[model samples]
Target: MNWFKPPVKSLLKLDLQHFGGSTLFELKQNMATLGQQLQKYEGELSQKAIDPSATLEDIKALQKSKEDIKARFDVIKEQHDVLEAEQKASFEDKSNIQNIADPKAKIVTAKAELIRATIRNQAVPKDVMAVLGDRNSTGGEKLLPTTMSEELLMEPLVKNPLRDISTYTNLRNLEIPKISFTLDDDDFIADTETAKELKVTGDVVKFTRNKFKVFAPVSETVLRGSNVNLVQSVDRALESGLAAKEKKVAFTKTPKTGEEHMSFYQTGETAIKTVNGADIYEAIVNALADLHEDYRENAKIVMNYADYTKVVKFLNNGNSTYFAAPPESVWGKTVKFVDAATDPIVGDFAYSHFNYDLDVLYERDKNVRTGIEDFVLTAYVDHQIKLKSAFRIAKVIPAV
Candidate 1:
């Protein structure tokens, strides 16, 4: 479809007199929507054919074209909005028609214009002028300037009566691409520690008497046995009234308690990979040797380690090429690979961006003729992986 040439009248005509308040709102919305649609369709239509093997100069040219179209669309939409609002206001306020002729109206209008002039001179143009215009006053001057017309002075501040209509149209007239893909999740792991203490006690009795014992008492006889098993065995033996009572008892367990020691930790390795490439995927792994190194990293930073095993093969069978992947466990790394290339060309061609604002010559045109191709492999830990992220590539290559 030719987007630049929209059938404006056929698409935009409406019966303003019959449209109720609600319909007027809908019309306003449609105009706003039309503004956006004009820009979008123009952008899509303006896109240039991009060659996959194009050089930096070529890419820049294409970008410049796209940006230029974007700017044009923006300006065109603004103009459309202005025209639409002016049309609606004329329909809604029949009272404004007489203000152009009445002397009293002219006086009020001139006074309002004076204030607007003062404000523009004083660096405050909006507040008082807006209020004066609301009263259908010419915006605050006793005598309006030749440059100041009611319509001209108020054009910027007018509200779009077709707002609702423009909004509906915008909603109904959007253009964008859709994508679908699979997502995956994994697990998290770490190391940790704990403590215990022990206590032991033993008791025995010694013979005691006053400073000078009046008489000597008979010595108490004691029996010896395996007292380790019995808690009260020693006490029982000394306090026993009978002469000798020895019993064998055995304790197989230790008599003390214990507590385990506290545990401490040292920092461990967390390897992350930042992947980027064309047909072939290249992972730039930064071992995150220290906090200092980690802070210096960018979008390539991954939180945890990954194996990053990659397999490369052509979508269709063709000549194979080899390039070295970055060494495993490299910190602060970089990798580059030339993926798909165009068939050999005969002469140096002028290459430019999709916008075609600037062009460059590709010096090594012959070296990459045979359509070199590859893909990248990126393996990241569960925590390191970000879900539902989008990747976009804008490549432009010129034909021979």
Candidate 2:
């Protein structure tokens, strides 16, 4: 004696025309409708079997109806699953595009192209130039590539936040020729005495290019299974890897290789203020004060995430917080976080210069079958942390 519950109908009745063709929404709605019908048929069949006057013919009819509806329901469910997978892939592609600095115009253009192709019954390109193009195409429909979500994909990688907050210049050549510093001190004292011989002194600092490369081996299976934008994904991965290395070099006194660039933290002992018996907020203020007034206006604070969390927890009397929950910034300036083990640094990054070639080169090797294909990405960049004035930056080191 088994009892079956009636199928619940969805209140949402979507119009087919309202949803564009071959869309996720339309497929999902179709699936839901099929499910409701299948459920209704099952419930009717169950009730008929329990009816006292029900004959063998009545039961058999109900069974046949139930089987027919179930078959249709299964087909729609399978379609729904496939559409869901494709929709998920599209979302991932969109996320990758969003991470790029300026992608709105490109996205708009790509969408327009897709629409035009659909309307004209023409072939839509699997890959879009503006964003990473899809690699899988079946018939006229393109399949979304499976790839890691943006959060998980970018979690292990690091990007230089300073790139967003600082000025950038492109170098046409390898070296940047510029005067490092100039000084002219000559005083006029009563035309009687020849003005002290004019004294002019200066030197030049040349920034040269450093070649950086990252080698990543991707399996053919993963590439095909994920259906990811291989070009864009690899580019992003390399860019992030390079930026992380750059950030490390920018903050270190001595880089592992190549020319050493002076870091903001190497401001000498005089420019370093120890947080002795002072609150974190006050310590940061003292650090900013150490910088000249001209540089102070555009100064930014950089620190480790751990220290930043502590700074945000600072409280006023009565345990009231001075900052809004999860403060966006501190000291009226942008705060950038790094994976640094050292103390916080406050300085004007405008004086720090970084130049790079606009072109990025890629080399692919399929013959060197090392179990999978290998991709080599390379970029040329030159960076120098030159402080126009020694007093324009300060480091806040906590007392042991």
Candidate 3:
């Protein structure tokens, strides 16, 4: 018996209107899924054609299924195109702006134009040139809006604890001169210039272009209601996504190429993989004491909540009031709570420096080949180990 098919319009019309806010995000997903269905069905028809035992009816059934899915896919694709046009219209809608000449609004408008141009492969709005600044200055790169860039820097503090404690800089292709190691003090007169060969070794920390890209798939429906707010929403979403990624990059040691970030600027030598002690508390105290005298004063123990809880549970086991836990500092050093840490980081985090430029490069002019295209949020970032001896991993090894 042949399976009967219903009209595609009646079945799929309500789906677009009611699909989880019907944002371009969902529409694209819906279309991609249907596209795969059509492809798989076509493959089935090919297999059946070569099968001697397969009836013509078998091929017809598969072909009908493929056509049904394609028809539905076309509807959503059309909706996606209509929504993109509407978003472009919003970018062109000057009447919505109370003052077209307002500086902030103009910047917002220019950025919207750029985003729309990226989506549709259209010419960037002529007026955007004024706000875009000199593309030649940073080697064909444009800066992100100042406020938005600052927000990216600040968001890490709110979401990433390690980001808060480490030092920060903004200079591209930057070479920061820092003291890598110290020389012993000479027994000479305080005011006299002695010939003690200025032996403090130094090194340069060079900044490399670090690209942090976030793939934002605008919801088809969300863009439908867009005005100037479209840019704001997209930029904010990028900001949030970048900050979250930064958080991961900060804690992960030696992350892969794209995910490269500051992992406390410590080397294997500085990271304390083992501790000499009889108990958990004693081991931590010994580790802190083992840190170089130069760093001991400013050093703090950075432990994520999980590690901190383990320490508290072990130390407070004796819960004897006479020798209670300090409750704030660990052995006179401050305890900083950081997330995404497997083991506590012990160090003068100030010695771990991260440098990134404010000039952002967006890779536009590329077609949106898939349902979503990645927006590259790029900056030249580098990390410096002012003094390797300043950091140590707080890996606990209680007496067994």
Candidate 4:
């Protein structure tokens, strides 16, 4: 009693002009939506063809609809691919400009451009001008140029070893609570009313505060000389001094004077597992097994640079080295090389924590007269380290 009308669907119409303004990501998303709609229409056509009641006219109409949808989808897909290629090329050009490596070269180029813009009395890009700005812009006194500061910060230096393996906390001073459980008796429990009481023990680990300092003296001639790079010199002195001292304290044991500081090796020696006959890989496996299964996920290996190079030279039966090269990983775990680390240290670094009060501070003493007209540079920082548990240290052995 009811007349069946063929379902009517609106065809998708995309504006070719809109592609110029749209980003590559947006164009891709639009193309995906169009493809899905085309699929849905094709599915409907297939369903109608299989229906016994569908007439020859209905089948022909569905086929025409699918062909039209396919044509439109193809055109849009081609446009999206072209736009994506263009976007990638543009991104690479911008990346090249930002990734300029030489600090002096970048500074010279930026300064030259600023001079040109000033002489012509023309407007320069805010980002380019920002590189020359002295103030932080948020507030407070103005400091060095932002670009110079960034260049100084980017100087390569040794990083803290404990930071790679330990649970990091921002707090400088805090009490870390540790708990342990041990089985004293081997008796199995029966279905009776009597139950053996479990023993639980806890201890508090405290990390006291400590301070480290770096000092350097710069001559007045160097500061005044047009050819001398004061920023680079200052940056090198501060970074090198801090890196050397920090590496020494992190690995080597020092007697506790008025201030107590223990190295990672000294704190977790109980977990040490010796490597027999230069089998470093086997020793690392044993060290990992020493850790609780849950803690093993956070485990990492720390070794001296010389020992790391030696391990990399190890060959398998086929003569291929165990490690492909320096700076490569081992067994999917990160292997960090510390030039100052005397022994190989394998542990779940999350158990060791280092806290700092403030980052390195640079102070210039121009008023202090040291007989000569020299600018005294002093750097100061406060930091402390603590080990939460002994199990964190998986192994510590002298490099073979």
In candidate 3, position 161 carries an lDDT of 58
Per-candidate TM-scores read 0.18, 0.50, 0.58, 0.46
| Global Cα lDDT for candidate 1 | 0.24
The pairs that clash in candidate 4 are 165-349, 165-350, 166-349, 166-350, 167-350
Q: List model 2 lDDT by residue over 254-334, tens digit each.
A: 555554543544444312333322555667777677655656778887777776666676643445454433344457777
Tell me how candidate 2 scores on lDDT. 0.51
Question: Candidates' lDDT values, in order?
Answer: 0.24, 0.51, 0.59, 0.48
Ranking by TM-score: 3, 2, 4, 1
lDDT of 4 by residue, 25-85 (tens): 7767877876786787778778887999998767766676567667666766765665554
Compare the candidates by TM-score and give the number of the best one. Answer: 3
For every candidate, C-alpha RMSD to the true structure in Å: 40.2, 19.7, 20.1, 18.5
- Residue 276 of model 2 has an lDDT of 28
lDDT of 3 by residue, 185-269 (tens): 5443231111221223334555566666665555444454443446645766676666566556667776776434355533443
Runs in model 3 deviating more than 4 A are 1-113, 126-147, 153-157, 179-203, 210-212, 227-232, 257-280, 315-334, 364-370
Full-model lDDT, candidate 4: 0.48
In model 2, which regions exceed 4 Å deviation?
A: 1-158, 174-205, 225-228, 266-279, 316-329, 357-359, 365-370, 388-400
Instruction: Specify the highest-lDDT model's number.
Output: 3
